[model samples]
Target: MVRRIETDRLILRTVTVDDAEDIFKWASDPDVNKFMIYPLHKDIEVTKEWLRSRDIDGNDEFDLGFVLKETGELIGQGGIFYKEDLDAWAIGYNLRKEYWGQGLVPEAMKAIIDYVDKEKGIHAIVGEFAKDNSKSRRVMEKLGMTYWKDCQYSKFDGSATFDAYLYKREF
Candidate 1:
């Protein structure tokens, strides 16, 4: 089930079908999807399908919509995916270009990380970013995760791949 989390200026809650339009606003941005593994969304239909298929069972993963409390607008999304190979939760997020560099990611993520640790009984969390995505790298560092190693990631279809740096935090 989707859970609701409140921070100083934002709310982290499970995404729903109604959020399709807002999510598409960022999901469709080429600049936003540059380093993302998923292909740029061509239309709102694709985003709707993704939001519809997104799992909210709180099992292996959870995707949340980051809502700005001041305007109740969906600014972005963030979540933790369980990596079975590493036996740890991997954190990820994306935001609209307009909201970039505002330090909003760590605010939303800090809440998610805390929730995972307290509720899921997980002590280790990992984050990865494309080697050239320095913006994401900074966000990871601000989250107190340290550089762990370099790794390669590819889309499910194996059509595209890139080198990435892994960051880790263990409590």
Candidate 2:
């Protein structure tokens, strides 16, 4: 089972279709999705479909929603999933633009890293982001991840592309 995680300001737990409207708040925002692998959700149905497509019940991958503990507001979502091509796990996250620069993502990520390391016996994981995403790079740095290489990644629909940087950390 994917464990529920709590941090100083947030709770990270599996997100479901029931959370679609709340998730759409950020999933539909272009600024929030500037580097995402998926296209901007055009409607609530799109978000609902996307959520339904996730591997929410799988033990090896977690599709989590981050909720503010104080307000019970779902700010964003992220997850760690095993990548067969890399033989490792990849981590990704996003937050509401209004919550940026609050150190919340890192706090949530730290708890995830700890859980996987101690409970899952996983030692390493990687994160990659668009080269121009300085904020995401800072989040990787804050989590003690080091730059690994550069590559190109594009949206699944091929609508946009990015020059990307990959980072990795070992426990």
Candidate 3:
């Protein structure tokens, strides 16, 4: 099950196959998916199939849709998941390009972090970004995450790889 997290400007809630259309708006955008691990969705069915396979209950993954409170539009998707290697939760997000720089990333993520801290008593939270992704780096920094180490990440399909930085904040 997905958790519901509310912010002043957004509501993050369970993302289902019903959200494929709205999510595809950004999922299919090359610029938006450029740094993402998943392949560019060629059609809505791919998204629906993906959603059907998503494991939100187990794996300590609470994937959710970021919905605008004002108009109830799904703008993006992301959430926190357990990172076994770090023995901590790791954060991840992807937003519509139009929504970038509006500070929603930090707003939404802080809510998730706070929820995790309250519910799980997490000692530490982490966020990682490609070195070339300045916007993501800033989001981590704004969320009070400090650079922890140099890291590397790859696309889910292993089609591409990138040098990244791991950022962490301890509660």
Candidate 4:
């Protein structure tokens, strides 16, 4: 079963079919999808379909939605994409524009890193950010992730390549 993680300000939990409306609200915003690997969700049905296929029990890596503890508001989504070759996990997160400057992403990230470290016996966690996304890069730095390398990676749209900075932190 997928577990729930609580941070000071947010709750990290598995996405459910009931979360479709919330997912659509934030995911359909073009601004939120700007740096994401996938485009803004087109409609509620699309979001529901995506949620239906996210089998957290079977997948080694799966996505989870972030919610505000006090308000019960869905803020965003994040997950660890396990990398077997490196024996590490690649972390990714996206926050709604309204919550951008509140320092919630790092709060959520800390809970995830801590959980994976103890439960999964993770040695390290890594992440990549588009070179131009200064905010995200700062979050990596805030989480103590060191700059490890740089490379060009394919964009979500599959139309072109973009420069990205790789960051990592050992447990």
Compute each candidate's TM-score over C-alphas: 0.95, 0.95, 0.95, 0.92
RMSD list, candidates in order: 1.2, 1.2, 1.2, 1.6
RMSD (Cα, Å) of candidate 1?
Answer: 1.2
For model 1, how does the per-residue alpha-carbon lDDT over 1-171 read when each residue is reduced to its tens digit? 968999999999998989999999998999998888888899999999988887788576867899999999999999898899998899999999999999999999999888877777777889988899999999999988999999988865566798999999887
Arranged by lDDT, best first: 1, 3, 2, 4
Candidate 3 global lDDT: 0.88
Give the alpha carbon lDDT tens digit for every residue of 72-138 in model 4.
Answer: 9987988786888767799899888889988998888888877877766777888888898899998
Backbone clashes in model 1, listed as residue pairs: none
TM-score of 4: 0.92
Residue 90 displacement in candidate 1 (angstroms): 0.2
- Number of backbone-clashing residue pairs for each candidate, in the order shown: 0, 0, 0, 0
Q: What is the lDDT of residue 87 in candidate 2?
A: 72
Model 4, residue 2: C-alpha shift (Å): 3.0
Candidate 2 ranges beyond 4 A from true positions: none
lDDT for model 2 comes to 0.87
lDDT comparison, 2 vs 4, better candidate: 2
Better of 2 and 3 by lDDT: 3
Clashing pairs in 2: none
Candidate scoring better on lDDT of 1 and 4: 1
lDDT of 1: 0.89
lDDT of 1 at 161: 90
lDDT of model 3 at residue 7? Answer: 95
| Candidate 2, run of 10 with poorest lDDT | 114-123
Off by over 4 Å in 4: none
Candidate 4: which pairs clash?
none
